[model samples]
Target: MNLLFVADPLSSFSVKKDSTLAMMLEAQAKGYAIWHCHIEDIKSVAGAIYAKSQKIKIDMAGSPWYVSTQTKEMKVAAFDAVIMRKDPPFDMSYVTATWFLSQAKLEGAKIFNDPVALRNHSEKLSLLEFLQYAPPTLISYDLKDIQDFHREHQDIIIKPLDGMGGMGIFRVKSDALNLASIVETLGDSGKRALMAQKFLPEISEGDKRVLVIGGKAVPHGLARIPQGGEVRGNLAAGGKGVACPISEKEAKVAEHIGPLLASRGLHLIGLDFIGGYLTEINVTSPTCFVEITQQTGYDVAKQWLTSLEQYLK
Candidate 1:
């Protein structure tokens, strides 16, 4: 099988933790051809989508880790599968890339986490669709409205709508120190929107990342526990990741939501849960494959590829 990964530059990959790299390694082990490209390399010409991509070999022990055997322009449909593994700031550029990928789908390209689904689901805000399992949340650009939410909740977490890896997340306590400042910074003086959720003290335990693959939740989840004085439990924010069995509640929620998202073409999803409440629906580039596998002895990447194979069949 031929697989094309539309991702960031290969130079940026961390071999130790990058889930895309893990997938590539697994695909290579399975004797599948692998190609790589950045979103910018995708283009539309004469109503057909093409990518200026490189057929690459991954060598874990090598200094550079990858060798580009061939670089050529190929129709998006030529590949058996196209994996959208780009990380997000989810700006206009990302949106435009998805538009092209969506067009590619029409041209017979099979893309995972379908381009249209990527465009439709906001990682932080999509949780509103399943609010029965979510905390009290508010998404707004108005500082007053956010402040009112803070006042009502007494403790809250505010973050940018497009932030990832826990960037731009702030925890405001009941005292509300720096509340206005945080509101202005995140909201950009009402020029940009932000999300505010009633703080879940269970964060002190950990922020559990429940991976839903092939319409089922992985039995074990990686709990990213905050270190020191950190309020964010994201691994990028200096947290420790510990893999553990998912709770019954988590399994139930995953069983319910996983198939729905899979039916929408999101073959893989990362559902963030804090204090047993659904927090975010991470559709774009959901990770933790390496950590979960290394810690729990569960091959998440293998499971993902198995699911992909079944999906294609």
Candidate 2:
């Protein structure tokens, strides 16, 4: 099957840790026609969405890496499926790209983790819909709301509503100096929303990252425990990854959201939980397959592409 992946610059991928890169490499190994493009390369001309892209081949186990390039104008429909693998700052351009992809979908390209559903859900806000399974979360820009949360939860964590990879996330466990000022300075009021939740003590065990592919749980994943003095449990944020098993609580989280999201076009997703409470439902830029592969010696890219092939069938 032919697949197009929209991502960052071609040379920026670290297939060692990036699941998207690993997936592309795996697909190329299987003789699937793999193509790559960036969001900036996507454009609309006369009501058609096109990209300046190149077909690439990768060897996940090799150093020189695999190679193939066909720099040409490509349409989304030319591929069997479009994998939107770009990373996030989730700015205006990202939303606009999703809008363009939805148009491409209407014209007959199959998009995984649905473009329209992604633009609507935006990861963080979507989890609020299943609040019962999640910790006490507050979406507010109001300083008073944050202050009140600090007063009640006493130990509260504040994160940007659009945050990913644990960026711009902070813990306010004490009445530290300028706590109120920091809250206002970090998370804007009225204009944007910040997620304030009761800080969980179990975070030291590392947060659990569960990858859902084709509406089912992938076998291996990691428990990313935060280092001492760190509240954010992201690998990039100094969190250590330990090969850990998923608990019944993590499975329940997947069971509840998997079918619903898959039906909505979110065929692949990464759901984050810490100490068994739901945190984020990562629809856009869901990662962890690389770590999972390293831990269990299975190629998740093969699993994902196989699912795409079945869907195309």
Candidate 3:
């Protein structure tokens, strides 16, 4: 099988924890041809989509990790599967790339986490669809509305709508110190929108990343625990990751949302939870494969590839 991975520059991959790299290594072990490309390498010409991609080999024991064997510009449909694994700020450029990918999909290219779904689902705001499992949340650009929410909740977490890895998150207590400034900065003085949720004190336990693949929950979740005075439990925010069995609450929510999301073409998803409340729906590049596998002895990459094979079949 031929697989094309549309992702960031290979130089930027941290093989130790990169989920895409893990997928590539697994695909290689299975004797499948693998190609790599940046989203910028994609182009539309004469109504056909093509990517200037490189056929590469992943060397797990090597320092460089990957070696490019050949470069070719191939039609998007030529590959058996096109995996969109680009990390994001989800800006206009990313949106435009999805549009191009969507065009490719229309032309018979099989893309995971459907381009249209990725474009439509806001990682932070998509939680509204399943609010029964989420905390009281508010998404608004008006400082007054946000302030009202803060006042009502007493303790809240406010953040920009497009932030990732726990960036631009502020925890405001009842004292409301610098609340106005935080709202102004995150909301761009009412021009941009922000998301505010009633703070879940369960964050002191950890923020769990529950991965669902092929409409089923992976039995274990990697809990990213905040370290020393940190409010964010994201690994990028210097938190520690510990893998543990998913609680019954986490399991129930995953079972309910998994197939629903997979039917929409999001075959892989990372559902974030703080105390039993669903916090975020990570569709665009859901990770933690390496951490989960290393700690739990569960081969996440293998499971992912198995799901992909079944999907392709």
Candidate 4:
């Protein structure tokens, strides 16, 4: 089966520590012919979507490094599954890819985390319904509103609603001023909505990345702990990962949202929370499945593939 992964250029296939790389690795190990394409390589011609992709392979013990190229455009229907593995900023290019990948879906290709679902939920913006499970959050651009949230919560986290990998996330204490400048620095007035949430103190214990694949919560999970004096616990942001235990509370949260996410055709996603409060619902290229697998030696790749297979059949 041909599986095409749409991802960032910096991502490609060799970046092993990242979750997307791990999923690709498992697919390769299971002998599924894995192919890759960069966002820039994707194009639409004559109303049919195409990509300048090549049959790429990963060599763990590398030297000359990657061994494929020439970038020829191919029909979108040729693949069995297209994993939308691109990491977020959720910018125009990413949105454009999803718009075009919708064609691949029309051609009967199984695109995980369905294009519509990704379009519906930008990384930090989609799961607002379960606010009860989340810290007090406000999606706004007004500096006054942000200031008021800080006043009420005393401590708060300001995140760009479209960001991922914990980028552009800031924690503000009541003593911290200059929020007006910070909000302005984020964007033009009213041009964007910043995601502001009450800071959860339980972050010292760590934030949990609960992997929901194919609508089932896996036993494997990771606790992303912030280093001393940090509020962000993203691995790319220097957070450490420890295997974590999922409790009834966490599982119940998962169960509540699992069917909703699954119903949207988002087969693989990682929901994050701090102190038992939902911070984000990662539908667009939800990662971290590999981190948990490596920590617990659980192979979830088959679960995802098998689920897609069943649906497609």
- The C-alpha lDDT values of all candidates are 0.93, 0.82, 0.93, 0.77
Residue runs of model 1 more than 4 Å from their true location after superposition? none
Q: Which pairs of residues collide in model 3?
A: none
TM-score of each: 0.98, 0.95, 0.99, 0.92
Model 1's lDDT to the true fold?
0.93
Clashing pairs in 4: none
**Clash pairs detected, candidate 1:** none
For every model shown, the clashing-pair count is 0, 3, 0, 0
lDDT of 4 by residue, 48-166 (tens): 78877777676657653445644557877777778888777778988898888887788776788789888886666676778888878888878888888888888888878767677
Any idea what lDDT model 4 has?
0.77
TM-score of 3: 0.99
Model 4: residues with Cα > 4 Å off, grouped in runs: 10-14, 64-66, 69-72
Indicate the worst ten consecutive residues by lDDT in candidate 2.
59-68
Error of 4 at 260 (Å): 1.2
Query: Which numbered prediction scores highest in lDDT against the true structure?
Result: 1
- Residues 126-208 of candidate 3: C-alpha lDDT, one tens digit per residue: 89999999999999988889889988999999999889999999999999999999999777788899999999999989999
TM-score of model 1 vs. true structure: 0.98
Q: 28-117 in candidate 1: lDDT tens per residue?
A: 999999999998999998899999999999999898999999999999989999999999989888999999999999988999989999
